[model samples]
Target: MMRKVFSIIIFVFMLSIISTAYAKKVNKEINVVISVDKNRVEIGNHIRLTVGVEGAFDTDIPELSVPESFSLMYGPSVSTQTTIINNVVKVFRGFMYGFSPSENGKFEIGPVTLKYKGKRYTSNSINIEVVERTPFESTIDEGTDRSGKRVDINKMVFVELVTDKAEAYIYEEIIQSFKLYFQKGLPIDDLDYVAASTKSFLAEKLGDERRYEEVRDGILYNVIELRTALFPLVSGKIEIPPAKFKCNIIIRQQRNRGSMFEEFMGGGGRRYPVERSTEPVKLLIKQLPEVDKPEDFAGAVGKYTMDVLAKPAKVKIGDPITLSINIRGEGNIQTIGEPLLAPDGMNNFKDYDYETKVTITDRGDGIRGEKLFHKVIEPQSEDVDFIPGISFSYFDPDIETYKTLTHEPVPIEIEHSDIETPIRLSLESAGLAKGKVKILTKDILPLMTDLYSFKNQGVAIYKRPVLLSIIFLIPILIVVACVYVQRQRALLSNDVGYARKKHAMAHAQKHLSNARGLLQLDNPPEFYATLAGTILKHIADKLNVTSASVTSDNIYDILEKRGVSNEVIKGLRQCLESCDYGRFSSGQLSREQMESTLETAEKVIVQLEKQL
Candidate 1:
């Protein structure tokens, strides 16, 4: 017993020693460091900063303590990584911020301090320099200069971001857009990946980019536009970042010493770069009023009118009714969420879908447009005859006041529907007599109820004079079919525009039908290609331009001259782009998406014909 007690005492002493050693080895101090991506940047360029903390799990991000002269465009793009080896785990947490210089100068950013688990840490200060925006190498041609250097396409080709309004209230709708101007043709697919980052604002992308001609400073430029409906998330001065475009812009390749020999060897072409960017823009967003705000306003910041409608005005009591709520006007139509309806409105309906179909359209007047919302409901109350008036409230940034738009009540006519219960046929009464001379045989088949259609039975077919005369019309029909084919072939061979215009509808339909089958087979790439070609080819033929020259750059001007409705023109442009995106998007899309894209393309083509 004494020996056992001595063993226990020694074990307890060793455990105490191990505990003290572990406590001494665990480092409690966290290391915090601040690093900047670049010390100097153009006025619109983003200066990135990373705040890193070591050995931290439950620690707050250290304050960046940026100087007053810088504008924080976006912040705290958070990232965390962890690694463990030999039972020792290491964790690194980082926060990234993008800042734009408000004025050209040198600035110092902080000795920021942070605390974690009763321990304090500090980061060293950082210095940043800002300079005025510089133009990129602007002009490049297929020729070399006397200095043996290629000319840069500096001012000749550049990008600019434009907006209609200079100032807005917080959460107010603003139209922000980017435009690329070029003197020569470019491969736009390279820039297709370029997208507007709405880091500083809540945004809804306006459908399809618009392309048009703008003669700026006596230079006719091919312009491509990308637009967004932006609402400031916070009240402050916001600097909208430039859209980084990466495309193989045709630049002049410098001719080396072997240029003449290489050209003779069939290597003659221009060199292209991989990326380009537009200048950033700034907008002043003032704080919205805290007082005199309406209760019904559901974050709407535009001038709009509301229209309420019920499908199938006359309906049986048990039938489902589709309710359409449409809002049209200027401002952020898509940003307007669920409309604020009175409690009594649609109280008679008990069944409703949990989802709503919301669609937005841009009416040629910049971002001013239309929004549609759909909801399905079934009537449950017998006494209610109509849906009550619904109201939508919005703060008009232009008027600087709150305005409420009300839609009139939609009347619903409900008729009593008789309850239906299917009655099963009784074996004894449904002509299957139990003992009526019936034979059960393995080889015999059951008789069909109507082996022959009685409606045409016993009609005199051979005696009719019209039947005898039908054969005489056959030869004439064959001759007419042959003549029509010959005429069509001749026209198709001679007049390209007429031939294309005539068969555009048929070709589009055939492509869509083919895509339906492809969708079932899960073929995305080929499906997108065929669909895009259908639209592009159709438009090219309609404009009498070769498919190679029928590009987005010159489409708007041509359509406008051809007297197409602006609305239809916009829809066509959006649909064409939708096809391109469907073909080129890297992510796998669902059957529904593929189907929707096909439908949009068809609608655009049909509408184009109508508008023409």
Candidate 2:
């Protein structure tokens, strides 16, 4: 019994000794986390700081009470990490906070406290020295040449000017789009913008506010393009002034390391100051030549052709006729003048109403759009009259001559009415019958005939014959419903994805049509561009890939993965490559060659649809 008691006493003593050793080791270890960022720091400056804790404890930290000398921006980012190296586990825990000096001085951070395992652990007070910052060089132009133009340069306002052709006749269009990119990385209280003057140009602003991602040089910027259509006031050089603005940005920095885990999780780095923009930019413009300019030119340039379409070559009176004029050839489609209609007494047409729709290319072309005008007219007389022809005049830069389009006038034939009376009556013939009959007069009927006239009373209310029309509109609606239901049933019956592929087949055909149209119009560049864009957009939509990600290899990989036939896939790849070559090299494909491409795309779509 005494030996057992002695053994127990020795065991207790050994455990006590191990506990003391562990406590000593824990007291000696420390975990540190550092952070740096801006909060109430000086303008165009960043504030930095670090947070640390030294104790033998697993602690839940209370929030730090900051002083008036510094302003705390963000913090109390608590973290914990346990690392086992060589079986020796090191557990770290604490919170980090960032603050900036309100005024230039030495500011004390904290005697931050934490409680772990029923014990209080206090951090050593940290001192951050803040000093007045001297002016530094600008990132873009600091100590650069000031002799040229001293334009206010910064992030917000900038100008980009481009011309369709550097050399052209007067009235040729030169496009200049001014874009402004702005960002408030720091906390901003408020913001306002002011636009400067645009001189010596007819500026028509286009589009509402829009934001998009843009990369210039190597910097990624969120850009908003504010566009304006500019027509040169005179045939000479013109300079555009820069726009300007002022904005606020916050600055902060990490001071000290507090929790190592917080350091690792917070990107394992410190925060820094951010600066806002207070600058502007300028643009230089040059004008086209006035020499050898055509008289019919009204500022239309590049290459173009006018197409006119009118409905119902044969129609009766009181029928509404629709005229669709499409002026489709590249050059500046947006800036083209509205087609005019001449005055005629035959068809009493009202004033024309106008509307425009725009489609811009992925490449940096001038503009693409369709201008529409709607006109309503009524016939003034029953005589056969003609609707006057419209005149569309523009200068052909390639031909260097004025061209005028005089559309053929529409003729109307008014036929005499077939429903007419066979018998005729006269007052003298009625008198001969009256002499044979008894003539009677009422004495009560007084001679009040002066107050009323029976001369116009015998005329009929409606002299013209009315034709009956019983249109079976319900049957037409039923037919439409049948078509829609049949289409839906067909689509649903097939694999939905396969049906989608079949639809994509139409898009490929459309690309071929665009190519044919361009070739027939004698425009090789636009022919290839339209063909390439149509095919690329179609493929991208099919594979659910972004336009930027649709490279040739990626397309092939996607197609092969989808189990497309190797033969069809090869032909598709070849078509895309051909489009690319034609686009870049401006290679002209013959009509037969273009038709063959259409046939190839059709075959490929068919084969792929079957496989799918």
Candidate 3:
């Protein structure tokens, strides 16, 4: 037993030494590479440029000396990758950018340069050719598949941006959709979408992504679609920018030599990245007509009807009466303001600020929902007999006219309050006869007459050493507590990172509780989304970075660098991927699966708390 134990100790020591040597070697090596998704693109199209650094986690962003003809669209989406094989760990960081060319010409992008640990590394330069936009019909080409089947390459993959109307009134609901078409049997993954710019409109996601199969141009294809409801904010000629999408197409090839298991798995495949962009769309927005517009119109544009109700028809004066005004039937429900109450009719009531709640539902066609307003009003006097009528006005885009809906006054009965006021009186009002004061037998009791009572029964508390020590410690404890509170306040005010880290766990717990509540509702998508957000937000707070920029791709290296265990890291990755699947996939998850996911997430977070 002693010899076996000695061997185990020696083995552990040797393993540690080897790990340290490997870490040192990794720290000494650094590599930088820069590449673009495409070397040629049309003038209106954009290219993705990526700068990758290996063997290092912290490095300055590479700067590209862009030419005057090229414009930067969006950039520097950071992604981190970490891989461990045979106990060897490798770290990589990537920075990506989208660049659009203004004119047709050949341009050189870089010999990108990066600075790391006081050393400079350079990458090879890339040449890009920008050509004029080609007509859609002329862009199609014929190609052959692996089985020699004739295929239209352009028709194999494409994207389209469609709107229900090319022209609309201001604040009108317009359904805009983005559809991606790919050949039915082609394997596609890693879809990165950049939505069209909607700076001049109010946009809301309609619903979950729509997936189905369709036949286009006599070829069967699978389609993935996303929908948004947009309301134009201003009236004028507006040009909606083109939407961009990038995805990878997997191409399978047979391997020369491999194990039977590998062969059964179909060996491996290469990914071919493809990008597509839709043509720009122009829309003409007409201003709302000013003819016969309602005087109380609050810029509401939609079809709506109002219902006003007052509860508790019988009440005493000065008692609160709740007025529920519900406006239902669609179109920018969130932007709708509170309905106007007749001022003259409200003279007898004491009105307070009203609260509003909006409920919106996307029926896969357009935005339809209701806004409810709850106003509390108290009758000032018994003379008030009825609540005033409420009115709401909106432009009917279908009829091209302004319409007002009014509710009839709701009658109520008010009675005098039952409680009576107390009467106030002064000393003179009492009318009491004045008389000379007679002294009582004695104002104070005589001092303790018994000598035994005066004898000290116990030592005085102030005189005893133990008691005095306890009494003196009170102020010391108070001072210490005050100092601690002041230091905490100062830190919370001045140190952002410390404050975020301090509240990170509490915030995560709160969100987790909310997710738990969602679990009882049968809404798997929302529950998983909330759970995933909680984890990402917790890590973001710990690292003092924005939650929007934290993704599964980069989280591995981040946690690994922070010394998180491999088991916990893998569990976290699984949780996030499961959440992504639950959120976007059309299939439903079983209750047991959801419960297990939630448990796994909780465990991962608890483990992270110990290390992070």
Candidate 4:
């Protein structure tokens, strides 16, 4: 019994020694360090800044100073990590920030300072280089990957801005294509596209997005292409701003679990955000050539053909005729002006303003459509034999000349009125004497002499209370309705912020319903995308800002400034992060998880609506 007791004492003493050693390791010296994901970045691109603290449990948030040229997009996302190895314990905590540079230059990010245990700790500063163009653009011809292998940037991911022609005449159709290329089998999601600004042109989307595969630099890649038809409004060197998009790429990492069950389950993954932009495009717009230009040119620039049809070939003098003129071809159909009446046809008939109808068809390659004009003409004289032909003149940019299309005159026969008018006779010519007429018939009954029988034949409707009330109420209602309608119109026209705020709830609900439908379809990616967009859009509408500008980093501050509670903001952040995980991660969520996420989103949005 004494031996067993001695053994117990030995075990207890050894455990105490081990525990003390572990405690000492856990209480290691505090160290802080600052670093950036990339030292070199392009203007308008984002960089990640992280400040990590080692062997610290309680520390104040770091105070970071960024250069004037850089702006804080979002951050201070907190992360914690703990590990135990060989009887040693280590603890780490980090605060991350996302920043974008507004100007191009070399700048220092920070020498972040943190306070812990009544002591101050300073982190090393990081240097960054911000260039006007992306590294991919400058290094396309010569670049080495991290593995020291020469690789083309286009093989991984890139964007291209292409135009059908570099130069075009004013009002000519120019097809602009924005294409995104990524390596085959790449996992990407949460795409936010920013279209190029075409303020100096009239632009129309050609069709839906097109997806296909192509080989570039002997590497296979998947491509998404969007096309737009742009018609230059002015003649000069016009610049189209670069188009941009942000997306998240999923990277799967394997884990050494040392167990078959854990290995079978799967490895985890992370999302890396990426932003790409196309180079700005420049186009020279020339004025339509003046040499050999048609006098009646109505600024129409495209290939076109016109057909004229006049109905009612047979008509009487002063009768009306309908002229149907159809101008159809490939071009800017909406801008085609009305054709003029022929001089020969104008003298013999009177014409009225023509009614116009335009139809556009997008054939995926270009813009093709037709414009129809309905004109009414009336014959004024019997000598008119045929309806005059109509002429349409337009400048054809392909041939670089003016062309006039003329239709043959429509033949018609006119007949004079055959009905004769009856003659009127005077009383004297009729030989009938005019005098005081005698009674034609006797009254059926003698008039009542009693005064009671002569009571008011009809009741006075104006004296009735209900009728008077209705009559007075109608005009008041009309005036109120008129005022209400005018106020709504004015608000919609002038106060965009008010309009958006008023409709924000409805728009959010609509998107939610769409997301729910997507959920039923078992498309988690699309559902999450829709839900995320709805939340961002709702806040943007309330704040009168663009949805693309909102991010997790800035939304907290944005909401807090408007007096939102921390609890609600945290809930929103969780919802956003869940949606992002659902979008880019390779793992599929269970139905129950998806439903819970959806419910949480609804609840948070409801809370936001009330506060906002």
Q: Which number leads on lDDT?
A: 3
TM for candidate 4 is 0.49
Candidate 1's C-alpha lDDT?
0.69
User: 408-512 in candidate 1: lDDT tens per residue?
Assistant: 777888887666543324445534444443433322434445666556656577777797678778898999999999999999868756877887778778877
Tens digit per residue, CA lDDT, model 4, 30-118: 88877665566767767777788998756778999899888888889997776654446788998989998988888886688887767
- Candidate 1 stretches greater than 4 Å from native: 1-150, 185-193, 249-267, 272-275, 309-325, 344-355, 363-389, 407-612
Which clashing pairs does model 4 show?
74-553
What is candidate 3's lDDT per residue for 97-176, written digit by digit as tens?
Answer: 99989899888877888877788888767788888766444232222233221222465589999899999999999989
Question: How high is each candidate's TM-score?
Answer: 0.39, 0.34, 0.50, 0.49
Stronger candidate by TM-score (1 vs 4) = 4
Residue 215, candidate 3: C-alpha displacement in angstroms: 1.1
Winner by lDDT between candidate 2 and candidate 1: 1
Predicted candidate 1, C-alpha RMSD: 32.2
Can you write out model 2's per-residue Cα lDDT over 169-188, one digit (the tens) per residue? 44454554445453312222
Compared with the true structure, all predictions reach lDDT values of 0.69, 0.52, 0.79, 0.78
Comparison by lDDT, 2 against 3, better one = 3
What CA RMSD would you report for each candidate? 32.2, 28.3, 21.4, 20.2
Model 4 misplacement above 4 A = 1-155, 256-267, 418-612
